[model samples]
Target: MKFFCATFAMVVTSATQAEVFTYECDTPPLSVWEVAGEWCSPLESLKNGLLIHQVDLCPGWPPPGGQFVFYTRSLADFDGAATFFVQWELQTNGDSSEFVGVCPASLSLGSFGPVFYQIVIARDTAKFHRDDGLPNIYISIAPDVPHTYRLELFGADLYTWYIDGMVVASGVPEGAYPSFYPAMNFGTRAWRLPNTTRWNYIRYGTIPLDAAGDYDSDGSVDEFDLSFFVECLLGEGVPSGPGCGFADFDADGDTDCDDWVAFQAHWTGPPAVPPIPPPCAVVGDTNCDGAVNVLDINAFVMALSDPSAYAIQFPNCPMSTADANGDGAIDILDINAFVALLQ
Candidate 1:
């Protein structure tokens, strides 16, 4: 019941024939689930329309081993600031790629400055952003501009570079950790540690899935956090004040006690919704808006090409303060909506 795909042409480098804007999929109707389990990306057959270089990701895009990368196995204390981001197209012919900030597998391939891989921000029960198993190695660079790197590792010994976001080239240059059998990279690579530089389409992983509610990635964990954990089990969502504690974990809240003892987590692989009650059913969400961007993809393509007899229910999420193409997916990269309103 869903087949929208048209523009797809990728050949960035078969030795530089350079066609870059890829996503034309459909090798012969191969991936067919059209609904439930959600496979669907055969590029939907191509009727000549898929050019979403607005960097699409709805039904399928970036689902390929990308996004959802979380790694922090070893770090006793580096504590700098470390950060992450991805999303491009500054008209992109390739906008001068060099982004590979966050390395630390133990610094060997030209290890320079800023390498902290420690994920123990723990506050535990209070949920201030729990991680506190304690040891410490954070990096956090956000100088903005064209370059920002963070390579580090000490549980084994490796470190690399970062400068505009600050950590200024702190190498250890010798190398280790990467050969786990091919790849699982963090800070994701298009090339930066040793230097290649198509730059970065985006890749990040350090490995942290103790239970995975993804904390609050907002990528998707529907039923609205089990409908806000059944509205915090029926009390109606409480526990706030700082970071990640909407239910203090499995007690009656959003999966927390290590995702509540880690049993039947979610994303069950089917039942994407629809017991029936959705005839375009959004019903004046008052302000909950879901997928419609650029302050709302041309306003839902001009509200479905207006003549608006009426179709309400879209509200929340339309107030981006110009985190500006920072590309972190706070709604498909907060698309600048040309930085103003519509005409």
Candidate 2:
């Protein structure tokens, strides 16, 4: 009944190039996972402008049995707003699966090519029920900041939604999680995403992982990694195999789910994972086995250069300590040290 959200703090990148804010949740006081973003884009269409309470989320996260929740207040698009919608992303690997959240969706009164926004109410919450039946959950953004957004989603015999900190809506869509119905997604086909919309005070809360390093997509890593690993044993992909980032928990160049196991082994508490050892005389016990091995060593390497990538490699590993050389926690200095060891 009592769950903690991911502790996140926004990292306002650059106002000139959009930014992402982060805050940590479930740290003790208020374990609410929250991240905010103010950017244009990051990847191809997935700009680095990831919102807070959601931006820094682990890709292909929540594994299978896991659950996740993010809140975006300011979501703006590039091309003229014609009516935008976000996809749940059924499968980042190849399925390109997706769904839409339309109820709380928005409509713009202003005119802006690349802009959108929303705000999180104080007493907003999502309640889960055992029954199957729910309405759409979405908020309508307007110049009026003092307004409220009500939302609800249905599974099958149950609905999930909260109103002003109350379970206004409850039930699961089709009696199954979105994972079960990869193709099912809500949308705002009725209204269009005008070229302009703004949001503010966005908040989020959730339990992202059942345990650390559960990147196998089955939720928990444990022995399941063997299955996801077997599936990608011979595969080769950056961070992840053909399945995207599900099994590449430790990014040790080996496609497997063991990464999730290692992450769970030393998570200190929270959705985070174990930490990869430093690059110096440091032990690469990233898996928290208290020894230096391929997993630790490889994860250590990723730590020096790419912190996020490093986290993905060894989810549980303390990526904060990735900086071996100490130039700046997991900076070029650490990379140099790691590479030196390779040479």
Candidate 3:
């Protein structure tokens, strides 16, 4: 069937953190999922994942046999300028053609635009099925094994797919339209056949990069990142420019004070590796050597002046305890309270 839909280019915004939505199929949360059609039984949560069984009895029924889709609740709608990513981990028991779809919020049962992007998986091969008259690119993958499928919707009408961490395909679709929300659907495609699929998990977000605060794709977050981070620091809700996503540490949609704190925590000078943050044991032990004394004096000063430097110097210790004044902020106001602890 010809379905109507569109694609969006990633937009620059410092409004809200990209929402990270994840579902583990082992215990599917029915409250957050919606089901459509008959003959397809509700998915059962198993130790392996969520199981979908396709029976052979309903071979020619219209809604029942044609396609049985399970989808998530609604999300905010956006136009062609929005950006997002989705990943699914799954495996099939036998030969099967499964469909995965995403649609806007106002999708209608009869509207062709309901499914913005559709993927068709037949056993060891998969392809993008859109109504835009473009030829589909089929990617061959390892069959019967669990596969990690990722879809990235970036730039205008542009998309890239990764299977098992390898880039398999990239393309742009024509005649795109706006989307209502970021909702997803999964089900059987075409005639129902006897087969089963276990969905291990599904995750999607705005910027789900491997390393947070590392805009340059480098291994560490350093001064090189700070320069770019400054440019992206448009306060909450205001639009940022391209590549600003890296500085959005708190994912609160902006590169403000909150993100700066998180950035300071991750800062590693030059190309050095950042140390794993040490636990905070005592409320005033900024040095993290299991003591609260003069040895912590210099560490406390650095924590208040240049938090990023403090992080690099005391990589194994937490700086949060620098708030000795208990005012919840590490500033000069806490000096008096901090001295009392030292004495």
Winner by TM-score: 3
**Each model's lDDT:** 0.25, 0.30, 0.55
Q: Give the per-residue lDDT of model 3 (tens digit) for 165-243.
A: 5677777744333354445665543343444555656655555343277654444566545544664666666654333
Off by over 4 Å in 3: 1-16, 40-43, 49-54, 59-69, 77-81, 96-115, 155-157, 175-182, 189-192, 208-264, 267-343
| Residue-wise C-alpha lDDT for candidate 1, range 1-343, written one tens digit per residue | 0121222322222221111121223322122111211222212122222111111123433322212112121111111212211111111121112222222111111113222232111111000101224322333332222332333332234343332223433334233433222221222111121211112222122311223332233334443233323222222243321112433445444333243223224533124531111212222121224322344444433333431311332221222222234343224333344233323
Best by lDDT: 3
Model 1 stretches astray by more than 4 angstroms: 1-144, 150-155, 158-161, 165-176, 186-343
Looking at model 2, residue 110 earns an lDDT score of 16
Please give me the total number of clashing residue pairs in predicted model 2.
94
Against the hidden reference, what TM-scores do the models get?
0.18, 0.25, 0.50
User: What TM-score does prediction 1 earn?
Assistant: 0.18
RMSD of 2: 19.2
**Which scores greater on TM-score, model 1 or model 2?**
2
RMSD of each: 22.4, 19.2, 13.9
